[model samples]
Target chain A: MPRENPLAPVERELRVAPRHRLDLVNEVDADVLALQAELERRGYGPAEARRAAVARLVPGGRVIRQLEDRHRPLLGRRVLASGWMDRAVAVGAGAAAAFAGVVAVVATASPGGAGMTAAIRWLLVFVAALMAANLGRAAARLWVQGDLRQEERQLLWARQTGLIVAAVAAGALGAAWEGYPVPGTSVGAGGPAFVPQSAVWEAIGSVAGVAVVGLAVAVFGLFGWLLVTPRLITDEECERRIDDFFAQSRPRLTPDSTKAQSHAQ
Target chain B: MQVTLSKRINELLVLAVLDQGPAHGYQIALAVEEQTGGSFSFQHGTLYPILHRLEADGRLRAEWHGTGRRRKTYEITGAGRAELAAGAAELEVQFRALLGLLRGCHAA
Candidate 1:
């Protein structure tokens, strides 16, 4: 059977292992130790320092969960600190970049003598934007989960795939733009004929259009991941905190399983 | 009751320290003690583990560089910054409510 997470303590007041003693940890981890010291500095008691030490050690989500499990009854501050807003920001950025790519493509594709190749250049720009947005989101998720997610891992790989495709398409576009030389007019024994110069904007538009597609892929892929994944990773750190804080207090109630599981990214 | 109050206060204090900039486990300890007039001092040994834990949780991140010889530095992440702000705001609300509660009887 699956074991209980070590971080999943039965009691909210549970502490860390003796070897991971608060006093011992305080001496080594300056940031939190400073926090513990400040408690003692402010004349707060040892127990208070210890509890705060644990809170500082764990992610805010875990700490908040622990507080709630204890029936602390107050949660506004903790919720805000979990950084949910930042996650939303990442999603929004991705969507906007994808939308821009689409617009570029349409402008390039227009038939009134609009140059497809020029539009393609604009598409490249959109592709770059798409890449940046996805990368940003991935980085945020990595930090949020304190690890990588399967979908995000896939997205990362797809990024490499995307690069290859872009390179090939760019090469083709370059060849077409330079080789054709904009329908150059030439004198022939047959008769005079009009040759239209390649429209720079048309190429720009085509590139932009292609970029839109790339952005769409990024947006949809991220969206699918968001939809499919339980989204447990974002809360993983907090969950660990919850498990640990409670587990330490009620040792017999639940065995610490986090030690056995390398669940976090 | 005191434990609850103290935990909130401690979080506030440490975050306030970080607001100044990032510091290592040792530096944070020193800063906390110094800021609190030595009334507070961590065991020094215990601080590192806690900092590691924080880093694990995304509240802080580590930056290792070759400084003179060897030393690792730590800084708060954006999430940590947000947490600090949230914590401060909560404390402010609590303090205000507490002040009002304390003053109500006298006013009446």
Candidate 2:
């Protein structure tokens, strides 16, 4: 009674190889979500969005490849490794700063040009340490996170760190060369105790100190922003999103039409 | 012993599963489970999407027919068969190489 079956079933089930299959359905789903978001932003309706999304994936174009590469396992792994490296550098720099500060404070308190030289040397070392740490953090975010937003935040932080440290280092070095106790009120002296400080060296050190302080203030203000943007998407969130993606992608990835129908139910 | 297959290797498994016979969706899913001794399971929701894409890409062909009730059946295309062959050969080479490495490690 029914029309001759259009499709005849083969006697044997097709065989699949163990290799060359990846549980990347979730990753593909993420791409679809991203694509959908883009389409919505562009004012496309849901139906149009889906059609376009399929078109984007098929015909062997590199479009899907580019999207897939973004969510690659290797990319996530690299991001995690970078985070570890950044944290390590940050800790090391903090330690170096503490060491340098202690040395500078102790050495600077004593009298003579030698004390000033030591202070300057210690300041230079401290600043260099801070710069290195900031650079490490920036590098980690840029290369590992693969998030442009995070990279920008790190870049800003690094720039401020560099500026502040450079000022501190230059101020200390100049003061040492000038052979003067930094021009501030001496404990017993009256009338702001000029202390016969050279106008040129004093002016250089003052400018450098002011610049460093300014940089520190800028970095402090921006610190909150750095924490807010580009958060490390947690492992749980990653897993959940990946799961959702696979679920949505099942219809397209599966070949047996009947299976897709059953699953859709 | 049950071997662990990762998500990355699941696509190959799908092809392998289909190779057993011309099965509708659920049947192939069952076959995969049976052959792998319940070690490997296909997610119904995810599997269909892959199947549709494979059909669209000409790796598989789908036909709608009525057998008392309406149902869709899919079969691998020539292209799909070729792909399976290539995939199998590549996997065999990899497995042998991995086995050699594992044996060497055990010897050490």
Candidate 3:
């Protein structure tokens, strides 16, 4: 007869949902036990074999999180849940908000006329892109499942995008300097095309403008890159974190197993 | 050495091994660890996500060996073979680029 999984207690503690329990998994139980048996045959003491087997597991919290992508709740239900879903829903609900922000831009601007409007429009795109990217990062965290390396790459992408936008903002400021009407009264004509003061984005003030698939799309694209390029972690600190953070939840070693190990030794 | 692998490499490596024949997770983990001389070790549990993801992505298929232990044996699908081929080609290109870059630095 099959034995109870060694990890049932840990599973209970984690309250791994019924849907994911199958995956929690019987395979792991079998593997750990089989490895333990093999180790004992090879003259490893019971405790030593048990330790060796336990060390092979991923970790507890991570097992549930990693499988989240596979066992994600149904769409309508998922959006109702908080956290990353809120980020996704906020982006989804943004069409109405985008319309309102457009109205705000229309109502708020002084008679700085078409020049200010044009400058504001470009600036709007820049600021909205940044906000959406920052907010959407929460969602990407779900996709990465706490892989610091992926998080590192995501942060790098965000910084690069910020720089590119800044470069374009500089050019726009230059145009405004040439009497092209930069976004704000702060940027008086011929004053500096690039205002050294106040974020060039200050122009999007009162504009709740944000919502785009760019950062998340880029994150997904990065996964494609990640699949082909492997970065091996050899650093002790980094490896330990990855090991601790990415492992499957496993059953605690039983006192009985320890005793067997001691007796064998 | 207990090196940590990015999911990218893990998927490709698992698919490459599965392509040889269907095997359980333990078998796959052992095979890779042994073959790599301990350089590409997995914490055993880490391999499951990649296995399940590939299965979800339709690149691999899994079946239970028996109900008692429920040992899952995974095999690469046609899509998996195609992915393995493409990924292997890309890795080769990267390896060559890395080698050339290092060589240039040495020559300098």
Model 3 stretches astray by more than 4 angstroms: A1-6, A13-16, A58-60, A74-84, A87-265, B1-5
**Which pairs of residues clash in candidate 3, taking residues 3 or more apart in a chain or in different chains?**
A47-A261, A56-B43, A58-A247, A58-A248, A59-A247, A59-A248, A59-A249, A60-A249
Deviating ranges (above 4 Å) for candidate 2: A1-131, A134-206, A209-262, B1-11, B17-31, B34-81, B87-108
Best model per DockQ: 3
- Over the stretch A124-157, how does candidate 2's per-residue lDDT look in tens digits? 5455445545544544443443333324554655
Which wins on TM-score, candidate 2 or candidate 3?
A: 3
| lDDT per residue (tens digit) for residues B1-108 in model 1 | 244676556555666677788765555666787899988655413344345555666878877543221235678888878988988888889899999998997798
- The residue-by-residue lDDT of candidate 3 on B12-38, one tens digit each, is 889988888887776788778888789
A best-first ranking of the candidates according to their TM-score comes to 3, 1, 2
Docking class of 2: incorrect
User: List-wise, what DockQ does each model earn?
Assistant: 0.07, 0.05, 0.21
Per-residue error (Å), model 3, residue A31: 1.6
Docking class of 1: incorrect
TM-score of 2: 0.32
User: Sort by DockQ, best first: what order?
Assistant: 3, 1, 2
Tell me the TM-score of candidate 1's A chain: 0.35
Can you tell me the CAPRI class of model 3? incorrect
